[model samples]
Target: MLLLGAATVSAAGQTPEAPKQAPTFRSGLDVIAVDVQVIDRSGAPVAGLGPEKFTVTINGRPRRVLSAELVESRSATSMTAVERAAATAGPPVVPTLPRVVFIAIDCLSFDASASRHVIDSARAFIDRLPPTDEVGLFAYPYGPKINPTTDHAAVSRNLATVVGQRHVPLTQFHLRPAEIVDLSAASSSANARDSSLLESVVVRECGDTPDDTCRRGLMLEITGAALYYEGQGNAGLGMLRSLLEQLTGITGRKTLVLLSAGMIASDTPGGRPDISELGMQVGKEAARSNTSVYTLFLDTTTTDKFQAQVRGADKNLQAVGRDSEILGRWLDQFSGEAGGAVFRVQVGSGEYAFNRILNEISAYYLLGVEPGEEDRDGRTHEIKVKTKEKNVVLRGRRWVMVPKRGAAAAGTVSPAPGPAESASAAPPAPPRRVVPADIQAMADAFDRGAAEFQRGLAGTRDLANLLRNFRGSETPWPNAPRRTAVFALELAVAALRSDNQNARDEGGRLLAEYNVRLRQPGDADAFECAWLWTEVTALEGLFMPDSAMLLVPAAIERCPREARLHLAHAIISEQRWLRGTAGAAEVPGILERYQAAVTFSETAAEARMRAAWFLFRAGRLDEALALVETRPPSGTDPYVLYLTDLVRGQILRGRGRFDEAAKAYRDALATWPNAQSARVALMTLLLSRGDRQEAAKLAAAVETAPADQFDPWWTYWLGDYRAYSSIVAKLREMTQ
Candidate 1:
């Protein structure tokens, strides 16, 4: 639930894209980017350098320069204004809200010694943050659990408590210095290994496969935490997706500083000795969701041969020392693709270069440019910020654009695999880009397929053509930005919609057979498939038409962890609740599933708010009220708040408090003046009062509104309002 409101928490992982109008565009997302500053043999803040002072690239290609400005604060921007306002007595004081900074304690990678150092570093980090920046804490140990960071006392208190958990083999946060050395000593007990009794607990603890490795008592807590929301049936990838989707919806900049090892949940492609394909998918999700990972790799020294792909390889290169040729190559490639880099500790050269890394961020530059396109599929784009002069060492944002539909990244993109790998297998090639024609054809096919479906003439081959076209278009990563994983999944959806079940069966067989293949994050086709499901399976209703039911089961199984898909399932399940034909027993299961659907959300907001509506339908008022009060509110999302208000009004009405209910409805309407539900409810209540004048007024209000904004619910009440209104108008004509 804490992850619901955290600045960085959001939907992750999806596929690739190309030049075209998006079915939807997530615009106004602000990126709070920071670059680690580097100097020549001499040290100085390279002032007077404009955008031309630096060169930015993604996969070694250049991008246009937007607005390059230093990280100046509001005080700096408004200094003259502040003085002017101070001189003008009785001037209005502008109220400001806190900019949230999430401080996470990841015990999975940190040993006790490192945990303490991180805590101390966090304290210093917090002190250096903007006064307007209020911090929050969370532990993914058991899910993304929230802790208070606003109060310095509370931060110190929580850090102290978390550090004290002691790195038992069960809770690996507190391994002694000697134990860390033991872990550091191993070349790598890489995923698949045979540990002798003489081997330390650490080696024995991480399982053969990466999935099983972090699956131990405390380390694999995020999944267990996922189970919490999942069991409620609201827990799905959509839960996280929706939250991140909402974050991307906002127009603000956020910098998420992660102080942990590179313990990414990667998919070990093709059963090779690597992580699963989902790890990179998760990273892609992170990117599209508008959060770039800034990893502060704790030097526990265990990362010898073990490549932690959680944070990309490019980030790893920023560190001073600690290089494994294989891992270095991976980091260099991964970081370049993902747009962030790593900071390392140079052993025997004093404390790992924390101070130097800090200076890098302190003197960093943020470039704001108008993305040529409006699509937010988060496709990786090359940024070029160069100095007009030579001999000026420079570093700024290397990658800025987030690839949506993570189709084969336009070039050289390598994503982390999901955490299920057989170490003995070979690694897959890096991800590549799509020909301009491929995605254009994809968009065209979807338009034709959807249109044909509406026309009642869509055939299997039509959809199959769409699938074949994509599959033949590009491989995982033909060149740069190599892992556009989403494209393949989108192909699956297109195939499932085929009038051909034989084709679908073949696709499903492939899913079960090659489940890892479709797990690439931000693959252009793949992410779109996931995002499409979120639409098809809205709690408001399914994203696709009821005809879409044919494809729902197939797509759900493809990415079964999707929360959006589950909520869509609950919408179908709600029909049973509506049908008295199913009798008493069926209704309870309907309510249970609906509630479960929303509760299962990884972020907890999307599903829970939807669940509140289900509870009202089930006549569970107290519970609905509780959910509204406790569940995280997505402040920027007026629709969510509007939905909550309807539930609240229903709950109030069900309790037989008509006046209060009416006022609650009115209040809800006042908060959302354009709400169709509130107006329809008002019109109904007015007709019941026999107030023809009032009824007529309400009826005209809705009648004049745009048809696109028309509420179907209003149609039913239109008769009642119009009947009285007609009579009232006739009587008024006689008097006038």
Candidate 2:
């Protein structure tokens, strides 16, 4: 067991001359926990065994039993001491619970019909789980999202949602015969080579089809299925491996139930390597984490005879075929090595299999073996446990990877104070105020990171780290406390956008406390306005418009001269207008706010561009044109300029001037070549003007755009690329 403590400093009612020592925050050593299960000859769980009844050996050396206890449903303990320590901003230490279950629906490998059945069974099992047991749901291969909950109603509803949706594997493996449209389109390229290769193989080897069309179709189907199966299997294995590694931090009965037919393989050795290496990796992680892997084979394929025939045909065509025994053996390797069992679900009995696995996890014995001097070395050690009683059996993890950082003994005391913090203390240090330059530097850094994120040059983890560096207590910025608050608000908004639940919860709590600070007396009006601005921005991102609108009037009143405050008001108006809850009369108020926002700001190009678009959309052409023509010659912000040109092109297109509208869009592209919105708008314009060749070229250019470049607005309404996708699909069909 690890002993953890924190040192804190208090200055309440202290004299200025009084001496005080700085607080020291130290990290705790790592502690490893293992889960053990004992059973009788008849396979019934053997309970009531105390710590003294068993002897534990680590690497052939006997160790003391720190604590041995049985964890059962309905009597779960509250958060552990380690859990509370991990809650603070520090190195993450995952705490073990009584039970943790992850139901990974193998949507990538399973077809829609099979996935539907699996979802139904998963829902039923969730409804019957003990209220104390924690569970998370995941769609495998895609690594969608994990929603951990104990709420049966919510879990059931989520499971239903999973059933209603179809998950296509997004693994980066392209197997589809590049859309063959009129052979003439790609005849002079690599398509000619691939077609020739395919024809020779099909006609010479199989000769089962009579015509080129039939043979081509058959070969394409066989090759696509093989590549798709191999890709999905590899992706699923990678995700499962990651899950096991994460579970190492937890201490209880962690169980992962994979619902799928099994891992697929190709008969060609080079097509798919033997998956034993992956299985071994899973076993090591499971043993280290004391977790279990339960593979529930869904038998999704058809009857044995039909499946055999299909496999045979696949073998002849692509030198690949389904091998159930190979898949089953690998599953057994993982489960048995992890002290778990594999179950094949009988026809229409998926619910039964799920319940059986749940029962096994609900009641398990937890064994805590204190590490010896030799066990402290960072190495894998084999664990052996024996019961003194007769006619009894034992099942638990066979080995564990000892943590490099060993914990202190359970009953150790704190050491004596050092010279600096002794009885003859030094004089109190002067309080330091936050530096003004530091605040500006931090804000600039944040702005740079945010811009990079907008341009798809930065990732979510990078943004998260940037925010943490600014807000945490460890940072050197001693002055500008309000700036940190604003950074926290930005972090919250980013978390919500990225669907990071933990960051969202923590940031929400901090921002809520700032709300309390907002009403306190003696605060600067500027700070209050900035706080309100951050709050309104977060609310808008969360789609809580009513709450956001309620704060606008107070914010405008607090900082009447602040341009951003007025822009916030205009944004709220635009939200209401788009929602149809406000009438066209609100447009004038929006226009006034936008105009005021531009007049009183250093740079409000975005506001001006938005106002122009609003007027153009509302059919006030003259007013919109006047505002657009007044856009200051050029600006550094390509995004803003892109939006300006886009709005201008839309207005010009609305006036039936195709040539000028196309030129406006081309000008936007010149400003920012990667501006996806400009390309998409131009494509549509070209299509309308019967310029299919130009339109097709543009569509092809963007079809290969980096996935990250299309994000931050990738969602339907906000992302311009959504329109690009729809137009491209239409163009493809029309040309075909």
Candidate 3:
């Protein structure tokens, strides 16, 4: 029986343009390419297969084969003169396509020695590949990434940095025999039993005889362990999915070799989803991108008798054995489901396993099969292949993703709608332009100074040290006057906070020089002037509100049509009035500026949300409600919708409308579930209404969520800090 793994391929010599409209189903015939490896009884690759020697089927229906070509690569030392002559004796080889491969190292799972062995094996594999092959690198759990290229030396350099970065498991609590037996006997679907087992473990580990305080401490520790494992699993999966998405635009077959000790499938209940569900999602993504996942399972067990003896003395031998078994099973299932196989590498056998993997990927037959109209419905379909030739075995992917008919003509993968797509349904911002070296250096210096200020180390000496770099012998860019003024304002604020009179006077003099230059004709553009105004207004509001009140009117006069300047003026005026630095007479002017900002901005959705927030804070509930009542159009920015709903919920809750407030919070979560503000607000409301059980569940979910989840509320009050770096890069691009 042929064990065929199915893969889809695009036709050679066809470069289809992107489709301009939504694709229709069953518009034309599409040829699906499959990669099949054929090996003899001695496990040597079988070559020279023709189109007439193979048969193919889709959903159990026979299909005609259009072409068959044997693809192989070998090092110069491995091929003999006779083999070379036979290779050239066939039809002309396909030269336009090159193989793409990625090596992903799971740094969070491998120990120091295991990592070293894996790196050595990977380097050997790269050395055997031909020069035309493209290679990429990715280190899991927030490590470095290099895109696909033919530079073998660069990949080797990056591999050296992966050592000693693995995470050590929690060893504070050891499970007793009873606890392990109870967990082993519980059904996988029994979530309640799993929760009870976890609580029991905490109780047993508290003390020989427990008290309330000891139990609380043990609970916190176990909770932290659960959160750590859950976060690592999700993050690893997310990174893998992102890498596959990036490869979708590249043509031809792609392979991803993942090297790791193992991933924790599930250590505790309610912490993470089951492995089957996650594996299925990943497998589908791989099929869509025409990529196969190969896993190199590195054994992490120690050979040192000293470490083994210590583990045995602590009575953790059984627990360690159980964890290893679970991890092994997880790796096996995940790799097989993603249309690839696993190669287990014990001590001293790393090279052998990698050599076996290389043999399979180095040579295969690319077969083109025609599918029926019903099969082209933009979904993944199972496939089968068989050969008339005897005494050989076939191995390849079992499924192929069939694009919609029009998409097949365009030679692109049309992604199916999923949760990630729904969350980011809005149009993305423009990509950042490349910045000049001088501007990048200045930005880096500014970032360092900001970091120092955040750490309470921004003394007079530190401010002078940071400013000295910008002071002398640096050729100025086109917008030098405004840029220098912004820097001077930052230094001045730091000096004021430190109560350093000399440093403050120096900063004031620098600012006066730049301010005069900025006011001169043709020294700065309208955009630069507006940017300087916004920066000055934000700094003064935080440190000295009186100064902002005096300068904002002059700023508005200089850039009368700039909506951002109007927004900044409104924000500062409201802040001053709230702090009692300005009287109630300024309230009307603040309201007028808010209205003007909304009217003049192209991003009116965001502007309206900000204005509604101001109204909400000022206790004008009716006006706030009116501002947010009109729902934004579909395909609007997701961030704007999220903030609008969050602010609306706050306004409704303040008016004693509990039901409406809860609905609004839910709406906000549906848009961006990773955000924490809406979830916290909803949990608080549940607690206030005597729904302790539901509130507790919400709190637990929030505690276990990934730590890197973004909450937009944290940056709402700061003026454009989220996009400040990208804005500066744009300024540098313009000047250069």
Q: Each candidate's TM vs. the true structure?
A: 0.34, 0.41, 0.47
lDDT of model 2 at residue 331? 70
Q: What's the number of clashes in each of the models?
A: 130, 3, 5
The candidate that achieves the highest TM-score relative to the unseen native structure: 3
lDDT of 1: 0.41
Better of 2 and 3 by TM-score: 3
Best-matching candidate per lDDT? 3
Candidate 2 worst ten-residue window by lDDT: 1-10
Candidates by lDDT, descending order: 3, 2, 1
Candidate 2 residue-wise lDDT, 141-254, digit = tens: 443446455666766776676531222322111222111111222232455547654444455434655354434333333433333333334445655665665665443356
Give a tens-digit lDDT track for model 3, residues 298-411: 765434213522343223566556555555555666665566777777645578767776766666676767777787887777777888879987766666766776564322
lDDT (C-alpha) at residue 697 in model 3: 82
Which candidate do you rate higher for lDDT, 2 or 3? 3
TM-score between candidate 2 and the true structure: 0.41
Ranking by TM-score, best first?
3, 2, 1
**Residue 539 lDDT, candidate 2, scale 0-100:** 62
Full-model lDDT for every candidate: 0.41, 0.54, 0.60
